[model samples]
Target: MNKLNVLFLTLSSMENINERGIYTDLVRELASRGIYIHVVFPRERRLGLPTELEIIDNIKLLKVKTGNITETRFIEKGISTLTIENQYLKAVKKYFGNINFDLIIYSTPPITFERVIQYLKKKHQSKTYLILKDIFPQNAVDIDILKNNSFIWKYFRNKEKHLYEVSDMIGCMTKGNVQYILNHNPYIDRNKVEVFPNSIEPIDRNNISIINNEIKEKFQIPAHLTLFIYGGNLGKPQGIDFLIRVAENFYKIENSYLLIVGSGTEYETIKNYIDSRHPKNVNLIKSLPKKEYDQLLRSADVGLIFLDKRFTIPNFPSRLTSYFEYSLPVLAATDKHTDLKNILIESNSGFWCESGDLDSFIHLAKSLADNNVLRKQMGLKGRDYLEDNYDIRKTANIIMKHL
Candidate 1:
């Protein structure tokens, strides 16, 4: 059989060989399955890439420069809009103009790429897949980041609809997301929308165990303490304020520690709280390399997931893969309807608590810490679940069947 040529478009800042991003993992999985993948990503200021293209394994990676402006302040939001739009247009013209693909799969956060997809579909007669990773305008509305009836909402909503209309198929990360899309746009074909959950490559426990002791020592994690590690974005969507509160409540627990290992908008806030409180059990670290993070996760006693209660659509955090890969039982704190809660309970791999319930969260953590046998049993269940469900080879086969 002739392998399909896939062109993946994403607005992510950078791609490292082992670091997991949706586009990065998908391209690698596809390449490993004999499909040829060419990826084009935005070359933002923070991302340093070679001028000449590079190939990793069998996949080609091309970085096109974007606007140099940094929008960290409230006043810069308007400037960011103009800057990003211009940069995306320039990137499309410079890098994507010459390429023709059998299929184009684009991930979204910034919906400005709708125009690019529309152009690609007409030019190449390709099937376009809109991998809806984030519900943008709606998420903004849910969090009061944007008013539902405001001009910004109306403008972006139109763009959102157009992006949906141009795509041949829409792949959502959860069933709730698929339903949300369908409910919002009743005219969209039900058959064209489907759930494609995040997946991970299997890890060899022997290889992981080799670095386990070193990772724990490097982090200054005590051998006797139960480490509950949260290893992803520290952002508003994570309800990091709630996490900080939980940390404050449990600061005195000698047998337990909360190790937070990532950076985002809320990093400074959490750092400040830790400094002021001087919590011996709460440790904050910047994001580490993927291998380091994976090793630490493997060594840790438990993995944590947190999502803001404000999020209406089910957010299945991609970080769950690391926990499952290492057979580390999860402690998911999110809204009531999240898809992750169901997965955790069904797999018997972890426990879930309502977001912002500090009392319940603390109790759950204490239970996990006190009951070593139960924790080990749950971890084993998660390992078995990952082997049966999230193996990259098996997931790639399912994706190829769709193609």
Candidate 2:
């Protein structure tokens, strides 16, 4: 018997495996089982950090310097995504060329890792796994960022197809994701696709009540009101305009408060609305550190999720797990295409409505705020659901079985 060696390539900048995130949680679980985890992540140009490798939490981390990929202009993001494959390949060769990996796992957003995967699979004879988190240029097209079937779209579409073709297994975030990939790319074998969801090592925050009030006081979160929070990325994908509408109409719901936390392209749009309008029931913050954000989650009564109604792909935001971890019920307003509504209904955890329906959101928001018993019941169910389905141990088992 031999200890497993896995190489994980991701676009997410994780400085430590102990950090709170889906990717970090999964790798931490693997490392706990005595597996050697090698993580290669990007060091964006904006950070001013050079390419370097360091041992963090018994995991090998290779930070490859690359162009600005996030929170930057469209041109820079495009160029960075285009060139990342070569940069990653060179980094992996220079650093871990001699080590033979048992498995190579990679995630999507760029969909330009075909060359690296092909090379690694051929060289190491290792199984390749594709964590299909983002559905590439199509998601861009859904949001009106990229024109459908344009030269740029076609190029990336081809890249996406090839990336799938090279992978030995495709792990999707949900069943909808699996079906979408199969339907869109008939060339792909359905047997290789499985539901590998956005999972995390859920913290037991249900019993921890020490800092709840202190954190509330620190953030000026009203203790008397039933707090509803919208955290994580606030970009176009989240339907920021719809969020603004929700904030504007939040006055209808009494004895409640809405807290919007995060930073993105639409941050200014939402900020301006909150600043100029000065909704007494709403509070907007740029962002918070993960530790503080987790504490803030404890003080919240409900979690808010919003998605653009135009998306054809089933986009599941990872923020749902954070709410579940803190035993907060979820209230989602998303496109009909996603299975989030079904999940919430089946789990008996929360409520959902179409993104554009302000009245429905208001009604649901009021109901959650007005009833304390209902909120606690739904929050418990959400925590149970997280333990049953979205735990990191389940993800580790699935990946290990495949390997």
Candidate 3:
């Protein structure tokens, strides 16, 4: 049987590891299935090359230099003066002209790449898959980042429509996302859309053990305290201010700690809040290496997930995988419609509260902290649910059928 030549297009933070991005695991999974995976990413700062190529684990990585742009500022709402679309096009023409792919899978947020996908499909006769991670223009409108009936709305909406039109298949992360796409854009071909949730390779529990004491000592986590960790991006979508309020409400409680172990635009805001208030129970740390973070997850009593209530799309954070991997119970606070709430409630993983409800959040936190048996049961249930529903091997099989 001939292996499929898969070209994956996305903006990845790194190529080699699965620390903070989506493409790494997707690449690894596809590679494991005998797919010839190639990645194209914008050049990293301090490394000046308009186009460079490297191979890792039988996969090709083509790094294209767009003008040097700081991702930090871009992530914080700073617009890129340099046109990434032109740069990406030039890179594809220059570096990837020799290769023909069976399928082109494009992930989006910077939905400006629809033109590139169209070009690829025209040039190579390859099927285009839109890995719909986030609903951009609609999400912007939902969050008030882009106003309805405004120029910005019109501009992004057109771009989004172009993307949907270009994709042969649209792979959404959740059923709600698929419904959102179909309902909002009634013109889109309904048969082309499908749900493919985020997945990870299951952890080998035999080889992994909770390093409770070491993690506690390193982070100054109290031996007696039950640690609740929020371990991912701290940004507008997460409603970090609500987390601060949760911390404040529970500051006086004994044997309970809140540790946030990631960075984002709101990192400084969260840090400043912690410093100004001097909450003895809350600790803020920059993102750590995956092994260390995973160990922390294994040791922690509860995993925390939060999202802004106003988000237009029902987001299923990939961070929940770490929690399930380590058999840690979750306390997710978000909009009622999110699939996370459904999974949590159905699996008996933990509790859910309204996004900004400090009172209910604190109440659940305190209850979980006090009840060891309940926490253990919830954790076991979550681990079992992940094994049944979210193993990467299972998801890979589904993808194989599509291919």
- Residue 300 of model 2 has an lDDT of 87
Winner by TM-score between candidate 3 and candidate 1? 3
Give per-residue CA lDDT, model 2, range 136-221, as digits (tens). Answer: 98999999999998999999999999999999999998888898899999999989999998999987654655445888887787
Model 1 gets an lDDT of 0.77
lDDT, candidate 1, 1-403, per-residue tens:
6767787777664457456654566677788777878777656555564434567766877776654333254235435544565555555567556767788888876676788778777888988888788877887777677899799788888888888899888888878789888997998999999876676677676666553577888878887788899998887789887888878887645498789999877889999988888776789998898778877887788899998888887777888878887878899889876778888989999999999998888888888888889888998899888888767666566567656
Quality of model 2 by C-alpha lDDT = 0.90
TM-score of each: 0.92, 0.98, 0.93
lDDT values, one for every candidate? 0.77, 0.90, 0.80
Best by TM-score: 2
Worst 10 residues of 1 by lDDT: 69-78
Which stretches in model 2 have alpha-carbon errors above 4 Å? 205-211
Ranking by TM-score: 2, 3, 1
List candidate 3 segments past 4 Å from native.
17-22, 46-50, 67-71, 74-78
What C-alpha lDDT, on a 0 to 100 scale, does residue 81 get in candidate 3?
21
Sorted by lDDT, highest first, which candidate order results?
A: 2, 3, 1
